[model samples]
Target: MKAISYSRYGGPEVLEFGERPDPKVGPDKVLVQVRAAAVNPVDWKAQAGYLDTIFDTVFPVIPGWDVSGVIVQPGVSVTEFSVGDEVMGYVREDVLCHGTFAEYVAAPVRTLARKPRNLGFEESAALPLAGLTAYQALHRALHLRSGDTLLVHAASGAVGSMAVQIARHLGARVIGASRDEGQDRVRELGAEPVPYGDGFTARVRELAPRGVDAALDTVGGQVLKDSAALLAPDGRLASIADGEVIALGGRYYWVRPDTDDLTALAGLVEGGALTVRVAASFPLERAADAQRANMEGGLHGKVVVTVDHDH
Candidate 1:
Protein backbone atom coordinates (compact mmCIF):
# COMPACT_ATOMS: atom_id res chain seq x y z
CA MET A 1 0.00 0.00 0.00
CA LYS A 2 1.39 3.40 -1.01
CA ALA A 3 0.52 6.75 0.60
CA ILE A 4 1.84 10.19 1.40
CA SER A 5 2.75 11.09 4.97
CA TYR A 6 4.55 13.91 6.75
CA SER A 7 6.67 13.35 9.83
CA ARG A 8 6.23 16.98 10.88
CA TYR A 9 4.33 20.08 9.90
CA GLY A 10 6.08 22.33 7.41
CA GLY A 11 6.05 23.02 3.67
CA PRO A 12 4.78 20.89 0.79
CA GLU A 13 8.23 19.29 1.01
CA VAL A 14 7.08 17.53 4.17
CA LEU A 15 4.71 15.30 2.17
CA GLU A 16 6.48 12.08 1.13
CA PHE A 17 5.09 9.55 -1.33
CA GLY A 18 5.92 5.88 -0.65
CA GLU A 19 4.70 2.62 0.78
CA ARG A 20 2.84 2.36 4.12
CA PRO A 21 0.76 -0.37 5.75
CA ASP A 22 -2.82 -0.77 4.56
CA PRO A 23 -5.57 0.22 6.98
CA LYS A 24 -8.07 -2.24 8.43
CA VAL A 25 -11.72 -1.38 9.07
CA GLY A 26 -13.58 -1.72 12.34
CA PRO A 27 -16.99 -3.40 12.68
CA ASP A 28 -18.71 -0.01 12.30
CA LYS A 29 -16.44 1.22 9.53
CA VAL A 30 -15.88 0.58 5.80
CA LEU A 31 -12.66 0.46 3.81
CA VAL A 32 -12.67 2.53 0.65
CA GLN A 33 -10.47 2.13 -2.41
CA VAL A 34 -9.86 5.82 -2.91
CA ARG A 35 -10.41 7.13 -6.41
CA ALA A 36 -9.99 10.83 -5.88
CA ALA A 37 -9.59 13.39 -3.07
CA ALA A 38 -9.80 17.16 -2.69
CA VAL A 39 -6.96 19.51 -1.72
CA ASN A 40 -8.32 22.29 0.48
CA PRO A 41 -6.82 25.35 2.12
CA VAL A 42 -6.83 23.37 5.36
CA ASP A 43 -4.53 20.83 3.73
CA TRP A 44 -1.88 23.49 3.46
CA LYS A 45 -2.93 25.08 6.74
CA ALA A 46 -2.49 21.75 8.46
CA GLN A 47 0.80 21.15 6.64
CA ALA A 48 1.96 24.56 7.85
CA GLY A 49 0.91 23.72 11.41
CA TYR A 50 -1.98 26.19 11.73
CA LEU A 51 -4.39 23.43 12.78
CA ASP A 52 -2.09 22.08 15.51
CA THR A 53 -4.35 23.45 18.24
CA ILE A 54 -7.54 22.44 16.43
CA PHE A 55 -6.50 18.94 15.32
CA ASP A 56 -3.85 18.08 17.98
CA THR A 57 -2.27 16.02 15.22
CA VAL A 58 0.21 13.34 16.16
CA PHE A 59 3.41 13.41 14.11
CA PRO A 60 3.56 11.81 10.64
CA VAL A 61 0.23 13.20 9.45
CA ILE A 62 -1.78 12.28 6.37
CA PRO A 63 -3.15 15.58 5.06
CA GLY A 64 -6.20 14.97 2.85
CA TRP A 65 -9.84 15.02 4.06
CA ASP A 66 -12.50 15.07 1.27
CA VAL A 67 -12.63 11.87 -0.74
CA SER A 68 -14.63 9.94 -3.33
CA GLY A 69 -14.01 6.22 -3.46
CA VAL A 70 -15.40 2.71 -3.82
CA ILE A 71 -16.13 0.40 -0.94
CA VAL A 72 -13.66 -2.48 -1.09
CA GLN A 73 -14.62 -3.88 2.31
CA PRO A 74 -17.75 -3.30 4.35
CA GLY A 75 -17.83 -3.85 8.07
CA VAL A 76 -20.06 -6.66 9.36
CA SER A 77 -22.17 -4.14 11.27
CA VAL A 78 -22.67 -1.92 8.23
CA THR A 79 -25.56 -3.01 6.02
CA GLU A 80 -26.10 0.08 3.90
CA PHE A 81 -23.18 -0.56 1.48
CA SER A 82 -21.11 -3.47 0.18
CA VAL A 83 -18.09 -4.10 -2.01
CA GLY A 84 -18.12 -2.09 -5.28
CA ASP A 85 -20.53 0.63 -4.14
CA GLU A 86 -19.39 4.16 -4.93
CA VAL A 87 -19.34 6.57 -1.98
CA MET A 88 -17.92 9.87 -0.81
CA GLY A 89 -17.24 11.54 2.55
CA TYR A 90 -14.75 13.31 4.77
CA VAL A 91 -13.17 11.76 7.83
CA ARG A 92 -14.05 13.62 11.04
CA GLU A 93 -11.72 16.53 11.76
CA ASP A 94 -11.23 15.29 15.35
CA VAL A 95 -10.14 11.82 14.31
CA LEU A 96 -6.74 10.54 13.19
CA CYS A 97 -8.22 8.58 10.27
CA HIS A 98 -5.43 8.26 7.68
CA GLY A 99 -6.66 10.74 5.06
CA THR A 100 -7.68 10.32 1.42
CA PHE A 101 -4.13 10.79 0.16
CA ALA A 102 -3.71 7.05 0.67
CA GLU A 103 -4.70 4.01 -1.33
CA TYR A 104 -7.35 3.10 1.23
CA VAL A 105 -9.14 4.90 4.04
CA ALA A 106 -11.53 3.55 6.69
CA ALA A 107 -14.35 5.72 7.92
CA PRO A 108 -17.32 5.14 10.20
CA VAL A 109 -20.52 4.06 8.42
CA ARG A 110 -22.14 7.30 9.57
CA THR A 111 -19.67 9.41 7.55
CA LEU A 112 -20.02 7.61 4.25
CA ALA A 113 -22.80 8.46 1.77
CA ARG A 114 -23.48 7.17 -1.72
CA LYS A 115 -22.01 9.58 -4.23
CA PRO A 116 -24.39 11.56 -6.38
CA ARG A 117 -25.63 9.64 -9.42
CA ASN A 118 -24.92 12.59 -11.73
CA LEU A 119 -21.37 13.19 -10.49
CA GLY A 120 -18.17 11.43 -11.56
CA PHE A 121 -15.61 10.32 -8.99
CA GLU A 122 -13.52 13.49 -9.32
CA GLU A 123 -16.55 15.73 -9.02
CA SER A 124 -17.81 13.80 -6.03
CA ALA A 125 -14.40 14.16 -4.39
CA ALA A 126 -14.86 17.94 -4.54
CA LEU A 127 -18.04 17.99 -2.48
CA PRO A 128 -17.66 16.93 1.15
CA LEU A 129 -15.48 19.73 2.49
CA ALA A 130 -16.02 22.78 0.26
CA GLY A 131 -19.58 22.07 -0.81
CA LEU A 132 -20.67 21.14 2.71
CA THR A 133 -19.21 24.31 4.18
CA ALA A 134 -21.12 26.46 1.71
CA TYR A 135 -24.28 24.45 2.26
CA GLN A 136 -24.04 24.81 6.05
CA ALA A 137 -23.24 28.50 5.90
CA LEU A 138 -26.09 29.55 3.66
CA HIS A 139 -28.85 26.99 4.17
CA ARG A 140 -28.12 26.21 7.82
CA ALA A 141 -26.48 29.23 9.41
CA LEU A 142 -28.26 31.92 7.42
CA HIS A 143 -31.59 30.15 7.51
CA LEU A 144 -31.77 31.09 3.85
CA ARG A 145 -35.05 30.94 2.00
CA SER A 146 -36.34 31.53 -1.47
CA GLY A 147 -36.66 35.18 -2.51
CA ASP A 148 -34.29 36.42 0.20
CA THR A 149 -31.24 38.58 -0.60
CA LEU A 150 -27.77 37.15 0.16
CA LEU A 151 -24.18 38.32 -0.31
CA VAL A 152 -21.30 35.90 -0.90
CA HIS A 153 -17.63 36.77 -0.87
CA ALA A 154 -14.91 35.02 -2.90
CA ALA A 155 -17.55 33.75 -5.28
CA SER A 156 -15.26 31.90 -7.69
CA GLY A 157 -13.18 29.60 -5.50
CA ALA A 158 -14.15 26.13 -4.26
CA VAL A 159 -16.64 27.04 -1.50
CA GLY A 160 -17.70 30.19 -3.34
CA SER A 161 -18.60 28.24 -6.44
CA MET A 162 -20.76 25.89 -4.35
CA ALA A 163 -22.23 28.78 -2.31
CA VAL A 164 -23.29 30.73 -5.41
CA GLN A 165 -25.10 27.74 -6.88
CA ILE A 166 -26.57 26.54 -3.58
CA ALA A 167 -27.76 29.99 -2.59
CA ARG A 168 -29.54 30.30 -5.90
CA HIS A 169 -31.04 26.85 -5.41
CA LEU A 170 -32.25 27.94 -1.96
CA GLY A 171 -34.09 30.79 -3.73
CA ALA A 172 -31.95 33.67 -2.54
CA ARG A 173 -31.05 36.48 -4.91
CA VAL A 174 -27.26 36.19 -4.58
CA ILE A 175 -24.67 38.92 -5.10
CA GLY A 176 -21.16 37.55 -5.47
CA ALA A 177 -18.04 39.55 -4.61
CA SER A 178 -14.92 38.54 -6.51
CA ARG A 179 -11.87 39.85 -8.30
CA ASP A 180 -12.69 41.70 -11.51
CA GLU A 181 -11.27 38.88 -13.59
CA GLY A 182 -13.53 36.31 -11.95
CA GLN A 183 -16.70 38.39 -12.26
CA ASP A 184 -17.88 36.81 -15.49
CA ARG A 185 -17.73 33.24 -14.20
CA VAL A 186 -19.44 34.25 -10.97
CA ARG A 187 -22.39 35.66 -12.92
CA GLU A 188 -22.57 32.47 -14.97
CA LEU A 189 -23.21 30.56 -11.75
CA GLY A 190 -26.42 32.67 -11.38
CA ALA A 191 -25.17 35.27 -8.90
CA GLU A 192 -24.49 38.93 -9.61
CA PRO A 193 -20.80 39.80 -9.21
CA VAL A 194 -19.30 42.73 -7.33
CA PRO A 195 -15.58 43.38 -7.60
CA TYR A 196 -13.74 42.70 -4.34
CA GLY A 197 -11.68 45.61 -3.02
CA ASP A 198 -11.93 48.79 -0.94
CA GLY A 199 -15.59 49.70 -1.50
CA PHE A 200 -16.89 46.17 -1.92
CA THR A 201 -19.48 46.33 0.88
CA ALA A 202 -20.87 49.59 -0.53
CA ARG A 203 -21.27 47.89 -3.88
CA VAL A 204 -23.26 45.12 -2.22
CA ARG A 205 -25.39 47.72 -0.40
CA GLU A 206 -26.16 49.47 -3.66
CA LEU A 207 -27.49 46.26 -5.13
CA ALA A 208 -29.56 45.29 -2.08
CA PRO A 209 -30.63 48.87 -1.11
CA ARG A 210 -32.30 47.68 2.11
CA GLY A 211 -29.17 45.63 3.00
CA VAL A 212 -28.50 41.92 2.64
CA ASP A 213 -30.24 39.20 4.63
CA ALA A 214 -27.02 37.20 5.13
CA ALA A 215 -23.38 36.95 4.10
CA LEU A 216 -21.06 33.96 3.60
CA ASP A 217 -17.51 35.17 4.25
CA THR A 218 -14.77 32.73 3.30
CA VAL A 219 -12.00 35.26 3.63
CA GLY A 220 -11.19 36.18 7.20
CA GLY A 221 -8.99 38.60 9.16
CA GLN A 222 -9.83 42.01 7.65
CA VAL A 223 -12.20 40.39 5.18
CA LEU A 224 -14.46 39.10 7.97
CA LYS A 225 -14.58 42.46 9.76
CA ASP A 226 -15.28 44.22 6.47
CA SER A 227 -18.24 42.06 5.56
CA ALA A 228 -19.77 42.45 9.04
CA ALA A 229 -20.97 46.03 8.48
CA LEU A 230 -23.12 44.91 5.53
CA LEU A 231 -25.46 42.93 7.79
CA ALA A 232 -28.96 43.99 8.84
CA PRO A 233 -30.69 42.88 12.04
CA ASP A 234 -31.86 39.64 10.48
CA GLY A 235 -28.56 39.16 8.70
CA ARG A 236 -26.24 36.23 9.44
CA LEU A 237 -22.49 36.09 8.87
CA ALA A 238 -20.67 32.78 9.05
CA SER A 239 -17.02 31.82 8.40
CA ILE A 240 -16.00 28.20 7.94
CA ALA A 241 -12.38 29.29 8.34
CA ASP A 242 -12.55 31.76 11.23
CA GLY A 243 -14.94 32.02 14.21
CA GLU A 244 -13.68 35.13 15.94
CA VAL A 245 -16.34 37.40 14.44
CA ILE A 246 -19.17 35.37 15.94
CA ALA A 247 -19.20 37.70 18.95
CA LEU A 248 -19.58 40.86 16.85
CA GLY A 249 -23.33 40.30 16.57
CA GLY A 250 -22.76 37.93 13.64
CA ARG A 251 -22.86 34.15 13.97
CA TYR A 252 -19.81 31.94 13.45
CA TYR A 253 -20.27 28.47 12.02
CA TRP A 254 -17.91 25.54 11.45
CA VAL A 255 -18.43 22.59 9.10
CA ARG A 256 -17.95 19.13 10.55
CA PRO A 257 -18.17 15.92 8.52
CA ASP A 258 -21.65 14.42 8.91
CA THR A 259 -23.11 11.49 6.96
CA ASP A 260 -26.56 13.02 7.54
CA ASP A 261 -25.57 16.19 5.71
CA LEU A 262 -23.79 14.11 3.08
CA THR A 263 -27.08 12.30 2.47
CA ALA A 264 -28.90 15.59 2.02
CA LEU A 265 -26.15 16.90 -0.26
CA ALA A 266 -26.35 13.71 -2.28
CA GLY A 267 -30.07 14.30 -2.59
CA LEU A 268 -29.48 17.79 -3.98
CA VAL A 269 -26.96 16.51 -6.54
CA GLU A 270 -29.13 13.56 -7.47
CA GLY A 271 -32.04 15.91 -8.08
CA GLY A 272 -29.90 18.29 -10.18
CA ALA A 273 -29.99 21.02 -7.56
CA LEU A 274 -26.32 20.98 -6.48
CA THR A 275 -22.98 20.45 -8.30
CA VAL A 276 -19.21 20.73 -7.75
CA ARG A 277 -16.72 21.83 -10.39
CA VAL A 278 -13.33 20.08 -10.42
CA ALA A 279 -10.50 22.17 -11.85
CA ALA A 280 -7.46 19.95 -11.55
CA SER A 281 -6.46 16.31 -11.02
CA PHE A 282 -3.10 14.82 -10.03
CA PRO A 283 -1.76 11.40 -9.19
CA LEU A 284 -1.38 10.42 -5.53
CA GLU A 285 2.42 10.65 -5.60
CA ARG A 286 2.18 14.23 -6.84
CA ALA A 287 -0.13 15.40 -4.06
CA ALA A 288 2.42 17.94 -2.92
CA ASP A 289 2.32 19.54 -6.36
CA ALA A 290 -1.48 19.55 -6.19
CA GLN A 291 -1.25 21.31 -2.84
CA ARG A 292 1.10 23.88 -4.32
CA ALA A 293 -1.34 24.73 -7.11
CA ASN A 294 -4.21 25.11 -4.62
CA MET A 295 -2.21 27.46 -2.41
CA GLU A 296 -1.10 29.52 -5.42
CA GLY A 297 -4.68 30.85 -5.66
CA GLY A 298 -5.63 30.85 -9.34
CA LEU A 299 -7.81 27.78 -9.71
CA HIS A 300 -11.59 28.20 -9.52
CA GLY A 301 -12.31 24.71 -8.15
CA LYS A 302 -10.86 21.91 -6.05
CA VAL A 303 -7.51 20.34 -7.06
CA VAL A 304 -7.98 16.58 -6.68
CA VAL A 305 -5.47 13.78 -6.12
CA THR A 306 -6.27 10.55 -7.93
CA VAL A 307 -5.21 7.52 -5.93
CA ASP A 308 -6.16 4.92 -8.50
CA HIS A 309 -5.45 6.87 -11.66
CA ASP A 310 -5.73 3.85 -13.89
CA HIS A 311 -9.34 3.41 -12.82
Candidate 2:
Protein backbone atom coordinates (compact mmCIF):
# COMPACT_ATOMS: atom_id res chain seq x y z
CA MET A 1 0.00 0.00 0.00
CA LYS A 2 1.16 3.56 -0.70
CA ALA A 3 1.67 5.78 2.37
CA ILE A 4 3.76 8.59 3.77
CA SER A 5 6.59 7.62 6.11
CA TYR A 6 10.02 8.64 7.35
CA SER A 7 12.97 6.39 7.99
CA ARG A 8 14.53 8.89 10.37
CA TYR A 9 13.26 11.56 12.72
CA GLY A 10 13.36 15.00 11.13
CA GLY A 11 11.15 17.70 9.69
CA PRO A 12 8.61 17.37 6.86
CA GLU A 13 11.50 17.05 4.41
CA VAL A 14 12.17 13.54 5.67
CA LEU A 15 8.66 12.39 4.84
CA GLU A 16 8.33 10.45 1.59
CA PHE A 17 5.31 9.04 -0.21
CA GLY A 18 5.86 5.44 -1.24
CA GLU A 19 4.69 1.86 -0.92
CA ARG A 20 4.82 0.17 2.49
CA PRO A 21 3.88 -3.28 3.71
CA ASP A 22 0.23 -3.41 4.75
CA PRO A 23 -0.32 -3.45 8.50
CA LYS A 24 -0.94 -6.77 10.15
CA VAL A 25 -4.27 -7.48 11.83
CA GLY A 26 -3.67 -8.81 15.29
CA PRO A 27 -6.03 -10.28 17.81
CA ASP A 28 -8.07 -7.51 19.48
CA LYS A 29 -7.35 -5.17 16.52
CA VAL A 30 -9.06 -4.41 13.23
CA LEU A 31 -7.63 -3.54 9.82
CA VAL A 32 -9.25 -0.35 8.62
CA GLN A 33 -9.25 0.98 5.08
CA VAL A 34 -8.33 4.57 5.73
CA ARG A 35 -10.54 7.19 4.10
CA ALA A 36 -9.26 10.19 6.01
CA ALA A 37 -6.68 11.01 8.69
CA ALA A 38 -6.33 14.26 10.62
CA VAL A 39 -3.09 16.06 11.40
CA ASN A 40 -2.35 17.09 14.99
CA PRO A 41 0.51 19.25 16.22
CA VAL A 42 1.89 16.12 17.85
CA ASP A 43 2.29 14.53 14.45
CA TRP A 44 4.84 17.12 13.40
CA LYS A 45 6.40 17.26 16.87
CA ALA A 46 6.95 13.53 16.91
CA GLN A 47 8.32 13.58 13.41
CA ALA A 48 10.80 16.20 14.56
CA GLY A 49 11.88 13.84 17.41
CA TYR A 50 10.31 16.04 20.09
CA LEU A 51 8.54 13.09 21.77
CA ASP A 52 11.34 10.53 21.49
CA THR A 53 11.62 10.17 25.25
CA ILE A 54 7.88 9.74 25.73
CA PHE A 55 6.86 7.26 23.02
CA ASP A 56 8.94 4.58 21.33
CA THR A 57 9.62 5.24 17.65
CA VAL A 58 10.57 2.66 15.04
CA PHE A 59 12.19 3.47 11.73
CA PRO A 60 10.08 3.99 8.63
CA VAL A 61 7.46 5.46 10.93
CA ILE A 62 3.99 6.39 9.75
CA PRO A 63 3.07 9.60 11.56
CA GLY A 64 -0.60 10.12 12.42
CA TRP A 65 -3.01 9.23 15.22
CA ASP A 66 -6.53 10.35 14.31
CA VAL A 67 -8.43 8.40 11.66
CA SER A 68 -11.94 7.94 10.27
CA GLY A 69 -12.30 4.85 8.14
CA VAL A 70 -14.15 1.64 7.42
CA ILE A 71 -13.24 -1.79 8.74
CA VAL A 72 -12.10 -4.14 6.02
CA GLN A 73 -11.35 -7.00 8.40
CA PRO A 74 -11.55 -7.66 12.13
CA GLY A 75 -9.15 -9.72 14.15
CA VAL A 76 -10.22 -13.04 15.60
CA SER A 77 -10.65 -11.57 19.08
CA VAL A 78 -12.34 -8.35 17.99
CA THR A 79 -16.10 -8.32 18.64
CA GLU A 80 -17.02 -4.67 19.09
CA PHE A 81 -16.97 -4.04 15.35
CA SER A 82 -17.11 -6.02 12.14
CA VAL A 83 -16.13 -5.59 8.53
CA GLY A 84 -17.88 -2.64 6.88
CA ASP A 85 -18.28 -0.73 10.16
CA GLU A 86 -17.40 2.94 9.88
CA VAL A 87 -15.26 4.10 12.80
CA MET A 88 -13.05 6.88 14.04
CA GLY A 89 -10.33 6.57 16.66
CA TYR A 90 -7.31 8.07 18.39
CA VAL A 91 -4.88 5.30 17.49
CA ARG A 92 -1.91 6.26 19.65
CA GLU A 93 0.04 3.36 21.06
CA ASP A 94 3.04 2.81 23.35
CA VAL A 95 5.15 2.60 20.21
CA LEU A 96 4.96 4.57 16.97
CA CYS A 97 4.91 2.39 13.87
CA HIS A 98 1.88 1.63 11.72
CA GLY A 99 -0.51 4.61 11.72
CA THR A 100 -3.55 6.19 10.10
CA PHE A 101 -1.61 8.14 7.47
CA ALA A 102 -1.58 5.03 5.32
CA GLU A 103 -4.19 3.46 3.09
CA TYR A 104 -4.88 0.97 5.89
CA VAL A 105 -4.32 0.84 9.63
CA ALA A 106 -4.50 -2.01 12.15
CA ALA A 107 -6.28 -0.29 15.02
CA PRO A 108 -6.79 -1.76 18.45
CA VAL A 109 -10.39 -2.15 19.61
CA ARG A 110 -9.78 -0.06 22.72
CA THR A 111 -9.41 3.05 20.58
CA LEU A 112 -12.20 2.39 18.10
CA ALA A 113 -15.68 3.91 18.26
CA ARG A 114 -18.53 4.06 15.79
CA LYS A 115 -18.21 7.27 13.78
CA PRO A 116 -20.86 9.90 14.48
CA ARG A 117 -23.80 9.25 12.14
CA ASN A 118 -24.14 12.94 11.45
CA LEU A 119 -20.57 13.31 10.11
CA GLY A 120 -18.72 12.35 6.97
CA PHE A 121 -15.31 10.66 6.86
CA GLU A 122 -13.44 13.96 6.70
CA GLU A 123 -15.32 15.49 9.64
CA SER A 124 -15.18 12.29 11.68
CA ALA A 125 -11.46 12.07 11.09
CA ALA A 126 -10.98 15.43 12.79
CA LEU A 127 -12.69 14.54 16.05
CA PRO A 128 -10.95 11.70 17.89
CA LEU A 129 -7.78 13.23 19.35
CA ALA A 130 -8.81 16.89 19.67
CA GLY A 131 -12.34 16.05 20.80
CA LEU A 132 -11.11 13.53 23.37
CA THR A 133 -8.62 16.05 24.75
CA ALA A 134 -11.40 18.60 25.33
CA TYR A 135 -13.90 16.04 26.63
CA GLN A 136 -11.50 14.56 29.15
CA ALA A 137 -10.18 17.91 30.34
CA LEU A 138 -13.64 19.34 30.97
CA HIS A 139 -15.49 16.23 32.15
CA ARG A 140 -12.77 14.29 33.94
CA ALA A 141 -10.13 16.76 35.03
CA LEU A 142 -12.34 19.79 35.72
CA HIS A 143 -15.52 17.89 36.70
CA LEU A 144 -17.51 20.72 35.15
CA ARG A 145 -21.17 20.88 36.07
CA SER A 146 -24.22 22.92 35.25
CA GLY A 147 -24.09 26.63 36.21
CA ASP A 148 -20.31 26.53 36.50
CA THR A 149 -18.38 29.33 34.85
CA LEU A 150 -15.52 27.76 32.90
CA LEU A 151 -12.58 29.36 31.12
CA VAL A 152 -10.97 27.71 28.06
CA HIS A 153 -7.66 28.94 26.72
CA ALA A 154 -6.94 29.03 22.96
CA ALA A 155 -10.68 28.59 22.47
CA SER A 156 -10.74 28.93 18.69
CA GLY A 157 -8.23 26.16 18.01
CA ALA A 158 -9.16 22.53 17.49
CA VAL A 159 -9.36 21.27 21.07
CA GLY A 160 -10.46 24.57 22.59
CA SER A 161 -13.35 24.90 20.15
CA MET A 162 -14.54 21.43 21.15
CA ALA A 163 -14.01 22.26 24.81
CA VAL A 164 -16.21 25.34 24.54
CA GLN A 165 -19.07 23.37 23.03
CA ILE A 166 -18.76 20.48 25.46
CA ALA A 167 -18.64 22.84 28.42
CA ARG A 168 -21.84 24.49 27.21
CA HIS A 169 -23.53 21.11 26.81
CA LEU A 170 -22.60 20.30 30.41
CA GLY A 171 -24.51 23.52 31.26
CA ALA A 172 -21.47 25.56 32.18
CA ARG A 173 -21.17 29.24 31.36
CA VAL A 174 -18.04 29.26 29.18
CA ILE A 175 -15.46 32.04 28.82
CA GLY A 176 -13.27 31.28 25.79
CA ALA A 177 -9.97 33.10 25.24
CA SER A 178 -8.18 33.65 21.94
CA ARG A 179 -6.56 36.45 19.98
CA ASP A 180 -8.74 39.34 18.75
CA GLU A 181 -9.26 37.60 15.39
CA GLY A 182 -10.62 34.44 17.03
CA GLN A 183 -13.05 36.11 19.45
CA ASP A 184 -15.98 35.98 17.03
CA ARG A 185 -15.76 32.21 16.51
CA VAL A 186 -15.26 31.63 20.22
CA ARG A 187 -18.45 33.51 20.93
CA GLU A 188 -20.21 31.53 18.22
CA LEU A 189 -19.39 28.38 20.14
CA GLY A 190 -21.36 29.68 23.16
CA ALA A 191 -18.50 31.15 25.16
CA GLU A 192 -18.08 34.75 26.17
CA PRO A 193 -14.98 35.79 24.24
CA VAL A 194 -11.95 36.99 26.14
CA PRO A 195 -8.88 38.23 24.29
CA TYR A 196 -5.71 36.25 24.95
CA GLY A 197 -2.27 37.50 26.14
CA ASP A 198 -0.89 40.07 28.65
CA GLY A 199 -4.14 40.78 30.50
CA PHE A 200 -5.77 37.42 29.82
CA THR A 201 -6.44 36.71 33.46
CA ALA A 202 -7.98 40.12 33.95
CA ARG A 203 -10.21 39.64 30.92
CA VAL A 204 -11.49 36.30 32.17
CA ARG A 205 -12.05 37.68 35.67
CA GLU A 206 -14.05 40.49 34.13
CA LEU A 207 -16.30 37.98 32.38
CA ALA A 208 -16.87 35.83 35.46
CA PRO A 209 -16.31 38.57 38.08
CA ARG A 210 -16.76 36.20 40.98
CA GLY A 211 -14.04 33.97 39.43
CA VAL A 212 -14.27 31.01 37.11
CA ASP A 213 -15.33 27.61 38.41
CA ALA A 214 -12.78 25.76 36.25
CA ALA A 215 -10.30 26.29 33.44
CA LEU A 216 -8.81 24.19 30.61
CA ASP A 217 -5.66 25.33 28.87
CA THR A 218 -4.78 24.17 25.36
CA VAL A 219 -1.98 26.71 24.86
CA GLY A 220 1.02 26.56 27.09
CA GLY A 221 3.29 29.25 28.66
CA GLN A 222 1.52 32.41 29.82
CA VAL A 223 -1.86 31.04 28.90
CA LEU A 224 -1.63 28.32 31.53
CA LYS A 225 -0.17 30.79 34.00
CA ASP A 226 -3.13 33.13 33.58
CA SER A 227 -5.63 30.30 33.70
CA ALA A 228 -4.21 29.30 37.04
CA ALA A 229 -4.69 32.86 38.30
CA LEU A 230 -8.24 33.17 36.99
CA LEU A 231 -9.54 30.08 38.75
CA ALA A 232 -11.81 30.41 41.75
CA PRO A 233 -10.47 29.11 45.09
CA ASP A 234 -12.23 25.81 44.54
CA GLY A 235 -11.63 25.84 40.81
CA ARG A 236 -10.03 22.99 38.94
CA LEU A 237 -7.56 23.43 36.05
CA ALA A 238 -6.01 21.10 33.47
CA SER A 239 -3.61 21.61 30.57
CA ILE A 240 -2.78 19.31 27.68
CA ALA A 241 -0.07 21.54 26.31
CA ASP A 242 1.50 22.93 29.47
CA GLY A 243 3.76 20.69 31.52
CA GLU A 244 4.39 23.43 34.08
CA VAL A 245 0.76 23.34 35.13
CA ILE A 246 1.66 20.77 37.79
CA ALA A 247 3.85 23.38 39.50
CA LEU A 248 0.77 25.61 39.78
CA GLY A 249 -1.25 22.85 41.48
CA GLY A 250 -3.11 22.18 38.26
CA ARG A 251 -3.39 18.88 36.39
CA TYR A 252 -1.43 18.21 33.20
CA TYR A 253 -3.45 16.22 30.73
CA TRP A 254 -2.32 13.83 27.98
CA VAL A 255 -5.29 12.39 26.17
CA ARG A 256 -5.83 8.65 26.55
CA PRO A 257 -7.56 6.32 24.15
CA ASP A 258 -11.07 5.67 25.44
CA THR A 259 -13.72 4.10 23.25
CA ASP A 260 -16.39 5.01 25.79
CA ASP A 261 -15.46 8.69 25.64
CA LEU A 262 -15.37 8.60 21.87
CA THR A 263 -18.82 7.01 21.86
CA ALA A 264 -20.15 9.74 24.11
CA LEU A 265 -18.66 12.40 21.84
CA ALA A 266 -20.36 10.74 18.89
CA GLY A 267 -23.64 10.98 20.81
CA LEU A 268 -23.01 14.69 21.30
CA VAL A 269 -22.38 15.17 17.58
CA GLU A 270 -25.51 13.19 16.71
CA GLY A 271 -27.49 15.36 19.11
CA GLY A 272 -26.18 18.55 17.50
CA ALA A 273 -24.25 19.48 20.63
CA LEU A 274 -20.82 19.13 19.00
CA THR A 275 -19.35 19.88 15.60
CA VAL A 276 -15.98 19.11 13.91
CA ARG A 277 -14.68 21.73 11.53
CA VAL A 278 -12.02 21.00 8.90
CA ALA A 279 -9.66 23.84 8.06
CA ALA A 280 -8.24 22.04 5.03
CA SER A 281 -7.98 18.59 3.43
CA PHE A 282 -5.00 17.16 1.51
CA PRO A 283 -4.51 13.95 -0.36
CA LEU A 284 -2.48 11.26 1.44
CA GLU A 285 0.47 11.81 -0.87
CA ARG A 286 0.55 15.34 0.41
CA ALA A 287 0.85 14.32 4.07
CA ALA A 288 3.97 16.45 4.27
CA ASP A 289 1.94 19.51 3.34
CA ALA A 290 -0.74 18.65 5.92
CA GLN A 291 1.87 18.45 8.68
CA ARG A 292 3.37 21.74 7.51
CA ALA A 293 -0.02 23.43 7.72
CA ASN A 294 -0.56 22.18 11.28
CA MET A 295 2.90 23.35 12.32
CA GLU A 296 2.27 26.79 10.84
CA GLY A 297 -0.63 27.12 13.30
CA GLY A 298 -3.50 29.68 13.28
CA LEU A 299 -5.97 27.17 11.87
CA HIS A 300 -9.58 27.40 13.03
CA GLY A 301 -10.08 23.64 12.71
CA LYS A 302 -8.38 20.36 11.78
CA VAL A 303 -6.18 19.65 8.73
CA VAL A 304 -7.10 16.30 7.25
CA VAL A 305 -5.31 13.95 4.79
CA THR A 306 -7.60 12.02 2.48
CA VAL A 307 -6.48 8.65 1.06
CA ASP A 308 -7.77 7.58 -2.31
CA HIS A 309 -8.16 3.81 -2.09
CA ASP A 310 -7.89 3.30 -5.82
CA HIS A 311 -4.53 5.03 -5.99
What TM-score fits each model? 0.95, 0.98
TM-score of candidate 1 on Cα atoms, chains taken together: 0.95
**What are the runs in model 2 whose C-alpha is more than 4 Å off?**
none
lDDT (Cα, tens digit) per residue for candidate 2, span 172-231: 998888899999999899999988667767766667787888989887887788788888
Q: Which model scores highest in lDDT?
A: 2
The lDDT of each candidate is 0.84, 0.91
In terms of TM-score, the best-performing candidate is 2
RMSD of 2: 0.9
